[model samples]
Target: MEAVDLTAEQRAIIEADASDLAVSAGAGSGKTRVLVERYVQLLRECSIPQIAAITFTEAAAAEMRDRVRREVMSDPALEQHRALLDEAAIGTVHSLGLRLLREHPVEAGLDPAAAVLADDEAELLRRAACIEAIDAAAEVGGERTRALLGLGVYHAGLQLPRMVAQRDAVGAAFAAMGAYSADWPSYVRATLEAHYEPRQTAIRGQAEEIAWQIRRDAGNVTERLAEVAGAVLQPLTAAREAREWGDFAALLAEARSQTNLQSGGNAPAAVNVKGAMKELRELDDDAGKLPAWNEHDEPALEVLAGLRALFEDSVRRYEAAKQAQNALDYLDLELGAVDLLRDHPAVAAAVRGRFLHLMVDESQDINPVQAELIELIAGGNGDGARPALFLVGDARQSIYRFRGADVHRFPAQQALV
Candidate 1:
């Protein structure tokens, strides 16, 4: 790490000690180089096994490991640490979780010999579990069963497996929706206000300006065009002042439906008045397009609730099948690792004690579950006494949403740190 060639930001990143950091660097801005330099600095005080450097893929992990090795080999003082690189936790988060689970299989409540299932094997198991859950639910014959059937069994059959595959994310969404069940109206109203209120305010100001100009230039403007401007301005004013969305929408509708303002001469005042009216009409047209949020029966929520029940049942069956076969899927690795860390205090303390620094690359793609696992291992809120957690990723490059990646978690974790 030569100071002569490094930028100020890079120097800050490398020199900053102990405090948690979330660095967002764009492509080719030497993000990887900065991360490698930081890792090298950590190696001066921490053993390879004491730090965790997690990325997205095997190739990336290999590249990062190679960079660390090269940096270590370049300096004579780091000779003793070179051999420990192979045992370092530098790989995908899933691989790290797998390592944790294998180390504490008894505490994790899993068979010591359980192997990770192949993609094809996991998909087959998911499909089987979904079918079994659907059949069992249908056999029970209840309101939910009827609701599930009403959504079309064939459609449910096609969609339920996909949903089951991402059960953790879907389950979390369902929980959030249930939490807001009593406040949907407030949520809807707030959303509407945030979006339309500003535009309405701008329109009101613009229309008022146009109205004043028309009045001041009344001697130059025709009487017919003045009447048209008055007609449009009245509703526009009412729409802007209306407190309720319904009243505002109705006013916009009335304004947009007014007779068109036409210019009969080349006079500048007539042309200005006509053009102003036309522009006002277009703006009101946009305002009128606001969606009316009328309360009605939401059958989809009921069907989704029923599907949610089936999804849970499917998950239980999936776990049972995996346990019977003595195998674990990728999801199982993370969930198991989290369970192991959170449920057993001794295991958690040992893990926290083992890793003094945690660094995650491409952290923007981490979902809530993975974030929770990171927190559990990092010893909670990253406050005093917690090991430093380094997160570096650009939110724009988050492309793993299908595997439950939520880009919002990046900023949120940054704020917490």
Candidate 2:
């Protein structure tokens, strides 16, 4: 109704009828006004009452809806469209996902009553399992197995529940800054590249050298066996021979009395070192699956497994609850929306068709997933055809890595511009 100061270039981009579109609205660049104008256009100019306005954050969505509502209340013409504005779908990606999940839980193979898993609970279960493996492996040899057992022992000794404060501090610090909360796997990969990979190679090389020395130490077992072949019933040499010649700790231990009778006074004190090593290895293999503190073999594997199962059951409950929640973190909203659009292409396309006049604020905060979701809805803008998108965001204000927001998406959008 009333013209606001806008460059002809801005007006052209906003009014363009394209299949796909992206607008790079810098901060304080009338981005919200652009969004409101587009909504008004759709309702008044395009006569589309049914529209969905999605934003990265619930706060942003609420802000936009409020401004639009304020406009509707003030303008007599828009006042008639106020009811339609009220009916318009406006939400964060996660809110939308939860809404859909509530409507279609069957599709996700999740019960409507499920819960979200708490990290502490998951950590507890993992620790219990790890400790069990370590205790079991204590009877074995080798630095690697020892290290595995040590992890279990460490877990057992910890007071995990008491460290809730520390855990929250860590989470807060991470969320306040850093990409670890944004894309965990990518962050881990970066960490490995910077620290672990080179160290791992060095450790492996050292292990090989140690293995060769162990083998050479093993050669003397046969000569010692010959010297004490008769005097000792089950010589240390024989025990060493059994362990070295073949993987036979259990085989050597069976009927120690019989072996002593056959050779006369020797049965090298029946130590199941090899069997312990095997058990240690089993724990080592499972340590990661278990907890960090309970990284041991002293605890029984069965006990650990049972505790782990309990923890997992709790975890399952927690996860289900979290998913069922109507609320979500910023990233969850984007991902959920992307999934919804991807799964229900027809519904998305129908929505997009109605919004040939879409405007987005905070374009810089849009991550890859959100970008894809917009693309799916808008079609391909640079190719040129309807409901072109006008996005306004200041790259400097684009500091939401905790929600996986990337500045890179802005550059890609720039090419389209």
Candidate 3:
């Protein structure tokens, strides 16, 4: 067997400066063949035999590895360099990221047994948040931030941060409604529709009804709940902080002294002290209003138990929502991973040092995060030394937009060299 021959252009491509080169060859123009020859050349010519070739797919990496082995073993001239070929690393960018992430999990501040976190994890967090929101709203009243977070969590696919930024845009749109108007509503409404797409109409109606009811029942949800809870808790909390232990006694007595203290029950308490009292009461007149847990033949206990269960459920949801916020989202993958590489010199050095050649098969499709990682691996060489930059991709083939890959990244900086 003989070594595969490279055409004149392929020869130029292979022998070109692998240190920093971007071949914007069109599709089906033998770009891969050029890569194979270049890789073999690096093994044969370049003393630096550590080849870390980043491919677009696992299959591509496999094929390249196979080609290199065939080219190395078949040719007597190159057979001596077969050992160098074995040291080559060729794989997808994702595999590379995972490798780096795994090697430096602690440095990344990631759990040793951290899961990639399925989309369901986000949904679980969102559902948990929603449940808490309903309960918190019932007991202590709703929070806009919490509501937004709940909506955002539930709609993880929508990219809440982006949607939130668009909220300002929607506000601007709302302001300029007479002009740039379309099939969109106020940002809030759009969020409502987008967030509640499954129950779009129903959720919208439900949220609207809840909003109106909250307003109607409490007459200004924010002020009512805060004012009510603040007024009561403020006095108690302030009194306690001020060492007014007697105030807490009075606060306790206020509840203990009141009879049919259902005075606050005209509609509902912005806070749930009335219901709390109702549940705490020894009354049996309204068996229907008894708590779920208390409903076991013991009329008074039923009311209290049901109320306790509901409140407990709400509080539990709130806690879950809080925890979900820390879970990894897609953005976490990019941002967190990049942060890990940059912050951990040891891990970064390990990867950057292990890979002598940083070959990105599709430079154009690289995101800021991916590009940043490449730069990190390349030791900020940006087309310099250490892991010699070997990028090959056509600007035209860079079709990915969501991962931050855009036409601007190509030939944008002096890295073009």
Candidate 4:
């Protein structure tokens, strides 16, 4: 392509030779133009089939492909490469997976002729699976069944499908690593442990330290101030000795229940007393982070676990039903691609060979599954030389969580690159 009147920043982006590049550009800032120009430059050195350009949507992909074709046509020197633009790998991640599976049907363990299920067909199958799951739960007739029944009654039997609709987001949330990864049970357990155990320990330690300081200063303060300080220590001592987790909240409440301690009038001595009282009250307020458990919380926790089991069973039934129809949904498409790349080394190598460079657009909206597929395709396993990875997205623009987008994954992927 001929050189055009471009800003220095746009020229730099097009000319940069970084192995892994991440562009953070806002809308109408020529992000697409930079990507198209960069792609055209790469095409001069690499075959069109050796590069992969992935976008979040088919329309964006088409626009990029069109721009690349236009650039090729604009250059008389690039006349021979015009026909190759039609064969370039430019599409959404789902389309990329579909192409991969189509190329290696046997390795992907699918019937060569198997088709993706239409939205209406998938919804019908999901409904059938939900009904079957409900009937099976009724036969069992236990806590799990009761939870499912309650949810179904509340949502008029749409609860299962609703949860299924959010399967991708839930799965992405669960798959996050480190402190971010926690299921319902794990979250509850962690919260309780933080509040009742480690948090209690820290609170007691801080209270004892403050109590000692109060005792040391009591003799220098007015009699009223000393009296208030002793009163403050009582609740802290009680909290330190309390064995029941339930009593901690009560102690905090008692500590905060003291009034008028901070309302002393404007005498010098009274002002000093009020200042001390204010500090003690602030400590009590800080201790209130430990939430009080309601009488129904224990029972509700039990019901939540049962409901989680029911949801898992429903998901299994839904997958089975889809498999029986030799069909794949959108989630299945992404997951199947990951599995194909991970399990079949020959196929993975073939894919790696086919695409030497990978450019992803709107990458901030990528979920865990799509991220995994990208990593695998880019040889991110540390087993070999990685491909040239180019990511362009504005994390602030990633708002597709209901469709399984995790904005946080962008930073993690950037770190990987």
Candidate 5:
């Protein structure tokens, strides 16, 4: 093949050894060109049948295939190998996975003629599964379940169908990208620890000062001021001894509920108690500013857990329904391919042998499942001779997160490579 114009970095990438490699470049920086050139170089050493190049989109795959074919045709000596290009694995990851599953149906545990459900068809199946899951949940009634049912009803009335319709995308994010798995309690506690812990000390100090002032002025203080001081002491002591998070939250709530302690009221002692009560109220307000995890957050967490469970249950039901119909979705293609490679060593070896060089485009846009697919296909399982794995992507361009693309995987995958 003729030497094409390439930057120093591009030349380095093309000349890299058979070890795994990751290439990062900005948009319009010839990433795809570098990939094609590298593929052509590999073709010189390996047969076209031994090469596999995966891209993010069908258009990119087609473009890459065309570019490679053009580069091959441009070389007079390489004309004989042009026909083998059509048989090479060059397509989107999903297409490659579907091909893998088709090639090893029994090993993948999928029917040989299983049909892939289109988006609209998958939506129907998902809706059916969600309805079934909701019915099942409703059959078993409890306080939590009732709360879940109410949420389901609210969702149904508001936007449940729309949300369910978009479940494939959202589910993909959760399953592949690890979204919504945050440690909320830890986060809330951390925030409170940072913002409220110091304030707790200040509030306790203020309570002690107020108590001292009341005792010092006891001779001049009215009955009303003494009673108000006792009211303040109750929660002050409770706050001092507050150990559990729930107790602290309750103390804050009780402090906030002292609405009767007005700034100035009809009673004569109200004037004397106003300043202390105002300070206490200010402290209560500060406590309220902290996360309300102990009182109001549990229900939210429970509901969120329930919704996640429902979504998972729906997914399982949806998968069962698809399997029963001998059909699959886009996700199933990658998962089935991965499972096949994982569970059957012989089959994995055969697949690995077929593609001696694996090249992936838009590597930053790949989710964990797709990354695993690439790793398995490239023999990253510490098994036999690992194939040369080449990846090209710009992490800054990883904008397909809604489609399960996780930019964080870029560094991790780079380290793995």
Candidate 6:
């Protein structure tokens, strides 16, 4: 209603109706204000149900709905649309998904009355699935499964639940890693390259810096202190030249093993050496203990294979278990919606036609599945007519990696926009 107080950038975001946009602004920069302003503009051009504002949390969605209502009611020109505000698609992505799945349960192949499981209930179901999967694997007694059992049933039981929880990520990693039955050393080397190289680089620099300090500090002390300093420096230097990460880990292990380096006659010198050794100990703690996969480590690889197989079994059983109880987890909601959209083009087109503007907030925390769902609804200028997707997020504020949030997607979407 008024452009005098709004900045040029805010006006641009509010007025950009045709092109997709990815906006990045820090906290307290009025991101929510921009979203509301944009939604107001979209509301003027389309019906209420044709606009969707997807937020990160339920509280955020509620706040957004309230703010939009306030903006609409505050403007005399927008009074005619006041009654339809509650009918707008304003909620979290999961909420939108759940709504869509409920609308088209037959297309999604889901039970119409399935309940969404709470966190505690999902954990119980996941654990039960893992236990059943392990029991089945033990019964089959394949070679790899037997090797996994060799690691001890207790250990398998402990580790499988974690694997089940991170099933999607672990499955992608395993697929990238190729067959565990391949050459063990080569497999280990590849794994190190993919995951451990960054840590190795950081640890190498830290160890060398500490070694330099120890050498300088020990020189003014006794010859015994100097000898102990040499002992620390040897591995530090060797670790620097190490061709493999396992060798570097071995060097740190050697440094860690030397706990009783003492000289009785020179108490002050011994104390000085001990202090420097204390820093080395701290360094060892920071140095990630890389797995030492030797050439003959076929059993360990077999165990990994077994674990992967068990995770597969567990996921199948877990879905079945949820189905039996007529319950679906959050993952099921997002993925089920994606499947409905992908497999049913008519349904996807119907939903797409209804929502001409798709706005997503806190988009940095979206995982691949969520991204796929978003793309399926409003991908691009494919048919020359679709919803214009507006993604707003600050990658610097992305902290949900453990929950499978990929901050990289924010910038990737920026490039597309």
In terms of lDDT, which candidate is stronger, 5 or 6?
6
Per-residue lDDT of candidate 3, residues 1-417 (tens digit): 223655677778788765667687788887888787787777665543466777765678899889878977887877767766655667766656655666677777776555454445645554554455444544653343333334343443234323321222323434442322232234334444354444323322332332333334444234434344334333333323322223433443342333243244343444444443343232222221222221232333223233323333443553455345544444345566678777866666666666666676766777656666677777453333366777777888876664456666756522744
Most TM-score-accurate candidate: 1
Give me the runs in candidate 3 sitting further than 4 Å from their true place. Answer: 1-5, 45-49, 76-87, 115-337, 346-350, 379-385, 413-416
lDDT for position 416 in model 3? 40
Candidate 1 lDDT, 45-85, residue by residue in tens: 87888899888778899999998988888899899998887
lDDT of 2 by residue, 229-322 (tens): 2222233234434422122223223312222222212233212222222333332233223222122423433343333333333334433444
Residue pairs that clash (backbone atoms under 3 angstroms), model 6: none
The 10-residue segment of model 2 with minimum total lDDT is 255-264
TM-score of 4: 0.72
Clashes of 5: 0
- Count of clashing residue pairs in every prediction: 0, 51, 8, 0, 0, 0
TM-scores of all predicted structures: 0.75, 0.46, 0.48, 0.72, 0.66, 0.71
lDDT of 6 by residue, 1-417 (tens): 467778899899889865789899988877888888899888777878888888978789999899889888999878878999878799988888998999997898878878998767988899999889877777888953674567677887777676666677777877876765565456666776778678778877777777676766666767766776777778777777887767887897687666457562455655666776777787677775655557657656776776777778888998899879989887778878999988888888888887888998988888787888888888832664568889899988887686677998778666656
Q: Pick the winner on lDDT between candidates 1 and 2.
A: 1
lDDT of 5 by residue, 129-198 (tens): 8778777777776433654665856573234334454465556534542334355546545665666667
Q: How high is the CA lDDT of each candidate model?
A: 0.77, 0.48, 0.53, 0.74, 0.72, 0.78
Tell me each candidate's RMSD, in Å, in order.
5.2, 19.3, 22.9, 6.0, 10.9, 6.0
Q: Give lDDT tens digits, candidate 4, residues 122-235.
A: 778777777777778778888677676556544525766666656765544444412321345456656677647877677666666655666566566666766776676688
Q: Lowest-lDDT window of 10 residues in candidate 3?
A: 286-295
Q: Candidate 1 — what's its lDDT?
A: 0.77
What is the lDDT for 411 in model 1? Answer: 86
Candidate 1, after superposition: displacement of residue 234 in Å? 5.5
